[model samples]
Target: MNFDERRPIDILETIGEIIEAAREENNLLKLEESIDILSTLIDNARFNQREIGILNYFLANVWSYIQRIKFPDEEFPLETPELEKQIIHLRIANRLLKDTNDNFKKCQIQTNLGNLFSHIGRFSEAQEYFNQCLEIDQNFEMAIGNRGFGLYYYARVVFDATQQFIFMQYARKDLLNAIASNQVYNEAKYAFAGMVKQIESAYPLKELNDFKKYKDFYKKLDKKEINYKKWSAENKLFINPLNDILTESVVAHDYLFIPTMILKSDDKLFFHSMFNQLKQEFVSVRFLFYESVNSPKPHFSDKEVVLMDTLDYSDYSFTLEKIKIAFRVCYSIFDKISYFINIYLNLGLDKNRVSFRTVWYNNLDKNKGLNTKLLTTKNWAMRGLFWLSKDLHEKEFDTTIDPDAKEIATIRNFIEHKSFKIINSFNETWTKKTETFEIDRQLFYDKTFKLLKLSRSALMYLSFLVYDEERKKSIEQSNELTIPVNFLKIKDADKI
Candidate 1:
């Protein structure tokens, strides 16, 4: 019973039960003690990945319960440190569970991750996780129901009418499926049915676009086209979850426009062209990254590979360089998005000074938080971008979602302006004594892939922010002018 005096394994055995009892008896003191004991065990004791994952999952659940107790309101998304703590632990648990074969635990962790993401207004990521849960076990009622429930709430916040209506239809379908599954809890089933009814009443079936065709084309085909499903367990380092995130983000970006507004100009074409170019750059980077991962060996015949007259043969190869290039390009895309933001918002901030990391802050005083003009826009996508920017900022502005944000920035800085080494393995001696930044090659790849995902998300948010503003402008200027703009499709041969 004295957990403080028990061995790590012994403590792990009893900790879950102790926490459950604490929750059952409403014993906050006991719960707090258990949390401390588990944290100590995790940090001090030797354990396998699975054990660590188990401990983290329990800790995350405890935090979740504690936060729910502290904040009983169900209307607004939670942004508390406690909630963030839960998310952090759950993410760790998910990563640790990746190689494990425990479908039940994977389902639980992924479902909770989805739930937490939804709780924090990151509905797209949440939906992706929920979809991942379904991929693991098709009959997972929690994920099934949560997806429907989350989609309903997500639809409420979406600004675009067509997208909103499409999401409502999807939500209705999932809710109905959840109800039919017969495994969902009664309360959840009631909620699902209620959402379905609301969707039906708000957007009638006849008024909506063909949901089947839309779903099949957009949702189903995306994963296949991304080719991430082919990434195997053997290639764990190459299997980035951000691949899914980026894929889903493209869906969001494309969904921003619905072809109803009749006003256009050369400026619109220029902006659209710029957006297209940025997207192309990102796509090329992602392709190179994947190709580097898939490459069996460096090809001597390839013109790109042969042109390297001065090559470092010290554990260096073209594949590695490709990865580094991808990382550099992906990181640069963030600044480009920031540049777009600067021009679009017309903040008149110095062109050189504006950056993704600094654009959201006040020109004079970043300590004042988000910029005044940004705050006034009240665009959800813009607000999301502001928060996303915090993840890349200094510790004082961190969002707690990415603990490695500072390290990532440091890596990017080192890559750009200083010495950065991506070794196959960690060299403690060199890493500790040398001024050069060194990271395990796998870790470097992971970070780069993450940067790519972040860039993709930023691009999506930028597009949606423009859509939100444009929608508002159309409403405000309804009586002002009517400009007929014609659309012409570019041929596939001239697309580039």
Candidate 2:
């Protein structure tokens, strides 16, 4: 009947009437008919910027609802192709309005683009568009939720074992962000929970120690203990307690103590001096003590007590030796914070910590630090850094040394001032990382001390190369005597 040729107002009126009729009839088929009528109106109408934007919004809502219905096998129906066609039509309608400089229209178009890409299994592309929508309007809950779903799908496509862990990390982050921003997004929340369950199921560690950490996490979440007796578990990733301890020690030293040491010390020499005092204090402490009767001889004699007392050991004598050792190691590593700051200032390294502290303090003052504010910001940064360094050999580098200095200052300020808000904020940041990132004491140690050791070793080798060029030449000569210094030798030497 050439209804599409009708006037714009007439087409809108016709569309409204059809949609109303479909609603009144309560028929799925009629709803489809109404969609078809609206599609035709949108295709033909010479809509203004505002009108096209509104229509695109309407179309987006309709498409989202339609996509929710699927075949018995949980696949989209054959009618989905028609929906995709309508999405393209909607995009065209919005693009025509782009010259009007309408942000709302652009956002709608991007959102629709994200939806279509997601439907077609182009999850990465969908994520791009969804991110564009968020950039236009961060508070757009729908866009946020949709981006979360896009990430979930992208995670599913990841194949590499190591990369799958990282994919799940981003997927979980996006889903959690969606839920945090919009609590009503049940679909996104469900997807996030389901994905976490899948990861835990696939990588179930068999050793009691490895499982204990997850067990503890689940216990804190009030999750029921898994009944291991029921399933025939295979392939356990062994837990190395020493490795765990070293990892956590490194993290804590790098992030916690080092920062504090830097903040407190005036210079490197001062820091090292104080560090030596602390180290001696820690090392001299005889944690194992024994009581002696008046008649019996004392364990080391009064002479030994006087000798040890003359040193820095007497004060910390009652503490556990391991605790003292850890404290000393923490203190020692912390003393290097000044080194990091000096290097950063001289080398023009990106001071992520400076901005991080500024933002953290601002949020703390506003009482917003704990409620997904700092965690989200830090997570974003971590994800970015993780991806940036994924292929690099510097994964174990001490990144927190400079940042931890500021953190220590902030923590000290909060402690001295008795500011509950600051305390709560700091605690929140720590707890959130612990919970989501699987950061334990051992992980912290590794990041701080173990990384420091590795970094120092590398630095020592680099220094040796710089200082002893002759030694390097001699080694190269020795190597050439055994094997020619060709491409393979060069490659091997470069590795060293």
Kindly list the per-residue Cα lDDT of model 1 for residues 314-391, writing each as its tens digit: 246778788889988887878788888887777777888778767877773466666777756656667667656656
Instruction: Compute the lDDT of residue 121 as modeled in candidate 1.
Output: 45
Q: Which stretches of candidate 2 lie over 4 Å from their true place?
A: 1-26, 43-46, 56-74, 77-80, 97-109, 196-496
Query: For each candidate, how many residue pairs have backbone atoms clashing (under 3 Å)?
Result: 0, 23
Candidate 2 per-residue lDDT, tens place, 63-164, comes to 544444433255554224445544555555555665665676677677777766566433444565776677777777667666656655554433334434
What is candidate 2's CA lDDT for residue 492?
28
- C-alpha root-mean-square deviation, each candidate: 6.1, 22.4
State in Å the error of residue 336, model 2.
56
- Against the true structure, what is each candidate's TM-score? 0.75, 0.34
Name the lDDT of candidate 1.
Answer: 0.69
Off by over 4 Å in 1: 7-38, 46-48, 75-79, 153-169, 202-274, 300-314, 342-351, 363-366, 370-378, 393-399, 422-443, 477-492
